[model samples]
Target: MLKEKGLLGNIGVQVVIAMCVGTLVGAMMGHSASMFAPLGSIFIHLIKMLVIPLVAVAIISGAAGLGSSHSAGKVGFATLGFFGFTSAVAVALALFMGEVFQPGMGVDLTGVEGLFSNVYADKGDLPSFWATVLGMIPTNVFQSLNEANILQILVFCLFFGIALSKLEKDRRDPLINGVNAIVDAMVWMINVVMKIAPLGVFGLMADAVGTFGFSALMVVFKLFLVYVGAILIYGFVFYPLMIKVFSKTSPVKFLSVMKKPQAVALSTASSMATLPVTMEACEEELGVKNSTASFVLPLGATINMSGNAIYYGLVAIFFAQMFNIDLGMSAYLAIIVTSTLGAVGQAGVPGPSFLVVAVLLSAGIPIEGLPLLFALDRIFDMIRTALNITGDAACAVIINDMVSKDPSHAAEEKVQNA
Candidate 1:
């Protein structure tokens, strides 16, 4: 609806306009627009820099912080279940839409010579399934970081963070503080890089449209519908049912309290950056106890990426369509599973699509197809980020009710204790 409604004035639309202008200018300039490619690489590099370290410290910080707490295992499990459930539904929904819509079917790839990097450049000895399992736990963390082995980094952080979490507070505080500082530093850098997004998006768009022309953009525009539609359905239909089925909270009431943080998330496109408001909404506005809010909201931001799950799912399948790669039933299953699990590892950055789309690498899509996706990202990012934050708040409400010994008595106790 970004194309139709257009009232929200989201940054995505502004970037979309910039892309359009870039296309027109590039069409006029013709071959000279080739210069924009390297300029566009600046944005891609920024995204890479943001995602790698961001995912690393986010996992570590989340693990160490949760480890420092004494949250009930029941609450933790329930929150995890909520995120996984919503994420599965979201991806499935997107996969269905992509199949039905075939949004990328008519997109032209002609003249896109060398636009995509050879995805198989890093293809190693295809591991036996067991070796693949072992591979995720790296022998050297620094080596994993250097290689940008996201899967390995995720596994290592899990263990390190869990170990750090179990240490006594006297020993744990320093590590936790250090992790926070690293994450903050990365955030600052990302903020600086984002200032160039408009120019970067323009260059990327100019190159893409000049190569493929306006006719192909119809396909991406339609694909954006798939992304945004899945988000809307999940937010309005899936979550409303979740609220009703899981607890007695009025869906309207729950959604109403979330408006402030949801707005913040929509504007910023960084759930981690919007954490303070989300936490406040969960605790003060929605009446979740601080004990539950403290653990669930933070963990949800780090790991609960239902929105990213859907975007990447649709994208993986879309690109597979573009390149004429048929992912069989098993690969379809892989997309769902990988995307869901990948969401857990997705960095809570301003533009997280780059990280999430790596899930498609498992399906054998070329990494070169990514710039096209990146050019169209901001429009989709706004919607997905809102879904991510809403999923977090909704889980807090649902799990707050779930973890209480007596749902009816819990509210009374909360008020009395407060």
Candidate 2:
């Protein structure tokens, strides 16, 4: 859509300009830059509006539509396990990278010391294991949607979707169709929102730089490098190796088919919103079985976030260091578990993936460091979303290969059968 229509037509160029302008203008505007916060907030609100519904319907349709597959249970359980394994490893890698690099070591936090003092006042306390598990099931689905509690929505969708799948074909078709329509409508809305993304980034950058000054930017930049480096290692090295080792499929062919989904994910910074395109590529481009693509990709989008896992690890460590907190071996290990689990429920938005919850749910890490982390969130969200998509595709590829003895012929038969 952003073809050669002149200066305003190119989003990449616009974002670059906005980043530069935001930093320069924010520095010049100083305290007065607070005025631009609302603009950024508007953009976030636009993106947020789509996340819950998009995820709900995407999950419902993807899971519910797996009715005709013979090994739905096997495929389903395998998919979930793959996600858990990959996410655990991703967080571990992040912890290692963060500990080695020390992204926030000696960074000044005094500038934003007071910014997050009250951000989590009511719910800042970390809940116990029982409370955390209970909270996952929303008391009311309507209320969960209103609050944008992703974990709750994911729980509801999983149950509701499986129920839909068990119904007679005629009984389930209408509900699935309705949900699919809503998902499509949401994707359309995302396209509209993305047209104005550069403006949103500008306002967010302005508020961030204006509030914390450039030193925080440097800290965030270092954190950004750590994240990007981890994503590269995971996406390029880890993911392809898994595909090659576990699957008979060519990584080159897999990535070639995945090119569109990866691009869409990076630009939108939302795996949930990019579901349709990703699924299409999986079935049509990659020749993955419908059973594998339907079950694996949807679950992966919500819970199997390699990128979020990495970010969670780094952010936890960075926050701990910023507050002069020393982490014991137990604290470090807890972060690995916390981040892996926390990532399971993290909404695929551009910034701050359940930051409040990660801080509240996990051990260690002061709340005061949130402002610095939030500043560069959008900066990191893109690459991580791409990594997130890569993981999803990898999961599908491996699962498809595992279930099929003859990958090519079986994929074709599954497609025809589906």
Candidate 3:
């Protein structure tokens, strides 16, 4: 039965089953909770181990591929514009959703103290916003690579890609091709690893259920609903309208091109992991120019996290409300600024955004309320990942329309053929 459904299909089914089974079993066998927690931690670490290298290689190779194409500069600017616009819209939507629903009103957090103590202990103090921004520029390339600093890696990739593009064709071709081949192999390896995602997800789900129990879900139900609802609005309404207004392409066609990448994003819950697939889909399936996809998607994945930004802001406010912290206009303004910067500066890895969310919360509200969010973090992480990738693709489409030498030509030809 599982085999008939295919790998990802089975993985999804397994995750649902695991969550249900874990909840029931944990409730029954409370004594065995310790065992399930360690297993889940191990699985999460394994996923974490793959993240830095995968992001570094994928972004570099994607940028290098863009360099091979001739229109790097125009494509780069259009991509920047797309990211800026979409990110702004995402923040707006998050604020709107957070305020309209007020996901944290009347939530009880008295018993949640011990729930996230370990998580809090692991988190260090947050650097100032300017410091975080300044830190993105690597002092030493090797050191940055060793540290797996995503922003530094991205800066290096951009310059290296541009330099490669500026080189003589013969000199650049061999290097670019070699890098591309390695990237392809790495992507294949990732796919193979992801086939075991069900196991990993099962472990993670078991741990969550064991620790929090299903009853704890009711505490944050409103926040969960708001987050999911906001993402859906961004995906269906905001993105399509942007495409129609700015791109001159049918929203339906754009969504079709985006489906596969979006699915990959939801499963992996890492935009960096989904970059290779996203770039490919954008270029081949969506007819986005290679130069555009190669440059835009990778860069966007790193810095253009519209979804994450919104999430951080909403969570900050949610936490404040839960703690009975009255956030005035200044605090809300601080949230908007800090969350936007934090999302861009934070590394695109699992669990890292939570760190940034922690930082934002500390700066804007009381840190004691952080634990409440940790209980529901994984569920929201998956939703945020989906939204992040969807934003990336939507930006790519908008940018593609902007930079196409003749957008009307392609649309007219397609219309005539249809």
The top-ranked prediction according to TM-score is: 3
Which pairs of residues collide in candidate 3? none
The 10-residue segment of model 3 with minimum total lDDT is 1-10
Candidate 1, residues 1-418: lDDT per residue as tens digits? 0122223234455556766788887677765776787766777666666666776776677556545443455666778788888888888898898998887787876654445655534532234558767877899889999987766876687568778878887898898888878866775665565556567767766775665554445547878877888888888888877888987688998877766666556545666656656766777767886656656766777779999999978898788888888778877887888888777766565553555445677777656666666545654775788899999988988877776655544665666589
Instruction: Tell me the whole-model lDDT of each prediction, alpha carbons only.
Output: 0.71, 0.74, 0.68
lDDT of 2 by residue, 1-418 (tens): 2222252235556667777888788889987887988887887787777877877877777677665556566677888888888889988898888889988787765555555654654554446689889999998999999888877888898789889978887988888888878876776776677777677778877887787777667766777887889988998889889988998778888767666666556555778766766777777767787656766777787777878888878777777766677888888778777777777767666665654445433665666556666667666787788889888988887877776764554675668789
Each prediction's total of clashing residue pairs, residues at least 3 apart in sequence or on different chains, is: 1, 0, 0
Candidate 3 residue-wise lDDT, 291-390, digit = tens:
5666677777788777787787777767766767776777766666666666676666666355554535544565555566655676677678777777
Best by lDDT: 2
Checking candidate 1 for backbone clashes, the offending pairs are 116-368
Model 2 residue runs over 4 Å out of place are: 1-17, 33-38, 106-126, 256-259, 319-326, 353-367, 405-418
> What ordering of candidates by lDDT runs from best to worst?
2, 1, 3
Which model, 1 or 2, shows the larger TM-score? 2
Per-residue error for 412 in candidate 1, Å, reads 12
> TM-scores for all candidates?
0.66, 0.82, 0.85
Report the C-alpha displacement of residue 113, candidate 2, in angstroms: 6.0
RMSD of 3: 4.7
